[model samples]
Target: MTWSIVARDPETGHLGIAVASRFFAVGAIVPSMRGGIGAIATQAFISPLYGTDGLMLLADGQSPESIIATLTDRDDGCQQRQMHLIDGQGRNAAFTGQKCIDWAGHIIDDDVSVAGNMLVGPNVIAETLRVYKETEGTPLPERLLAAMDAGEAAGGDKRGRQSAALKICRDQDYPWLDIRADDHPDPLGELRRLYAVAQERFLHVVETMPTRANPHGLTDRRLIDEKIAALEAARIADGRPSPSFATPLKPA
Candidate 1:
């Protein structure tokens, strides 16, 4: 019913998860992450506890493999669930319950894990991992989207697509970017559009928000405006279009 990719970006140490499913608001339950800790995607008899408690275990410095073992060892319904994770140390692991629907399984690699249940076939996760590895230097968010797109092309959820989500956490407890299309005709496509819309102004503001290093984030409106203008100017000078939700804004 769902497939997800959880990864730690080697370039920036950011943690991210992207998920899609033939279920309503899959984002709400399938994906969870804490900046600087790790990420988890729980589906197929989804358990929100796996996400919340799993992060606690990650914060405790437990290995991804250990965490999965501990969690499943305690859950009586473990055989009906599926999950995957990537810890802060870049170790990754995943589990597919024996009782999960056919076509259920996962792939784990250094700093990344892809898992799914009720998917079309093995190529779904295979293509996902392939695209993610191929786009090495791309930003984590874009890379995630591209990987999921490839999986969808390879045959995503055997049932159909209903919702999708993309979440990225750089170095804070909260997410740097989190977007969801709870229910849509083309959830993955909607996610891409939402991400593009985020680039327009939302992400610029996110950069100025409070973080651990700077408890008092950039609060001066004038300086914030200047910083955004500078970035936009640089983009234009490089022949890139301005970021905008509807139309690209012309450089002033």
Candidate 2:
């Protein structure tokens, strides 16, 4: 029903999760993260508590392995659950219940973990990890997306695709970027479009938003506006396509 990647960017210390599933609105339920803490993806039977409680454990300096054991050991539904996490220390771990559907398992690497249940086969997670490792220098968001794209190519959720999501967190309690294709014919493609659109304007605005380091953020908009203008100019100078818009369809 679902497959996901939870990773910590080695270069930036940013944490991110990319997930796709045959279930509707997978994004809202599958991913949870706190900057300077860790990330969690809870699926299969879908215990949201794994996310909330898991973060508390990570905050307490609990290892991903201990957190998973503590949560699953107490849950009656552990056999039907799948989860993975990576902590601030860059340690990672994953779990797949024995009772989960066939083709369900996980892979844990240095600072990343990939997990899934009811996927087409093992190649899905394998290729996902492979591409993620291969794309070392790329930004966290794009690297996660590229890995997911490879997983999909390898045969994603066996049932089909319905929703996908990408979340990135840097040094804030909230995400740097959180986008979803909750319900769509091509969820990942929609996510990519949204990511492109974000680069045009939304991300620049996000950069100006208040954060712990800069409580005032950028009260003046002039600088941000100039930055965006400069980027747009650079694109044009490079002969790149202009900023794009998703136009609404006219009534049939």
Candidate 3:
């Protein structure tokens, strides 16, 4: 019911997962990652616990293969499960249950795993890997989203696509950028648009940091006070009252 790629961007040390499915809200189920930890995709029988458990195992310093083996060993329904994992070191691994529906399988590469069950064909996974590798020069999330789009174009879920998602995390301690498109007519497309919006927001946050820095060594304290006053006025005009300070000018 799902097709997904779990991967590490070797150049950025960023971990990400992209998934699309005939299932509703696939994002809520398949993709998972933690900053500086690992990424995992669990589908088919779709054990959600594996996401948390796998990250914990990686955090405990387990290797990717060992973590996957332990996870598979503990699950009684392993044969019906599909999973792809990547550790912090960019090591990758994947598993597809022999009992999965027709056209089910996975492909593993140096830092990525692409897998799908009940797909239109094995080419879904193949095309996903090809796109990921070919788009290596792009940002991790954009490349992952492109891979999902390519898989969908190659014929994704046999039942047809309903939802898609992209999750990525960095070692820097801001919130992970997790975006989803559920119950959309073209969920993967919507997910791509949302990812673009997220990129803009990330840039806005990054730009705000520089504004806080004192770019000039000017000792005129009054200039700082005047700039603060102008900023407060602008915020008030924008219909957002300042939480910290009162309006510089009193109400008439």
Tens digits of lDDT, candidate 1, 1-252: 999999998768899999999999999898889988899999999889999999999999999889999999999999999999998778888999999997999998878989999999999999999999999998899999999999999999999999999999999998999999999989999999899878867898998898888998987878878877787778879998643457644779
Q: How close is candidate 2 to the true structure, as a TM-score?
A: 0.93
State each candidate's clash count: 0, 0, 0
Identify the leading candidate in terms of TM-score.
Answer: 2
lDDT for 251 (candidate 2): 72
lDDT of 3 by residue, 1-252 (tens): 999998887877888888999988999989778867888899998988778798899889898789779998998998899888998898878888888898899999998999999999999999999999999888888888889889999999999878888887776423257878889889988886776555433433432332214444355556555665676577768997433322355667
Candidate ranking under lDDT, highest first, comes to 2, 1, 3
Instruction: Report lDDT (CA) for all predictions.
Output: 0.92, 0.94, 0.81
Best-fitting candidate, measured by lDDT? Answer: 2
Stronger candidate by lDDT (1 vs 2): 2
Cand. 3 TM to true fold: 0.80
TM-score of 1: 0.91
Candidate 3 runs further than 4 Å off? 172-175, 206-252
Q: What does the lDDT read for residue 123 in candidate 1?
A: 98
Clashing pairs in 3: none
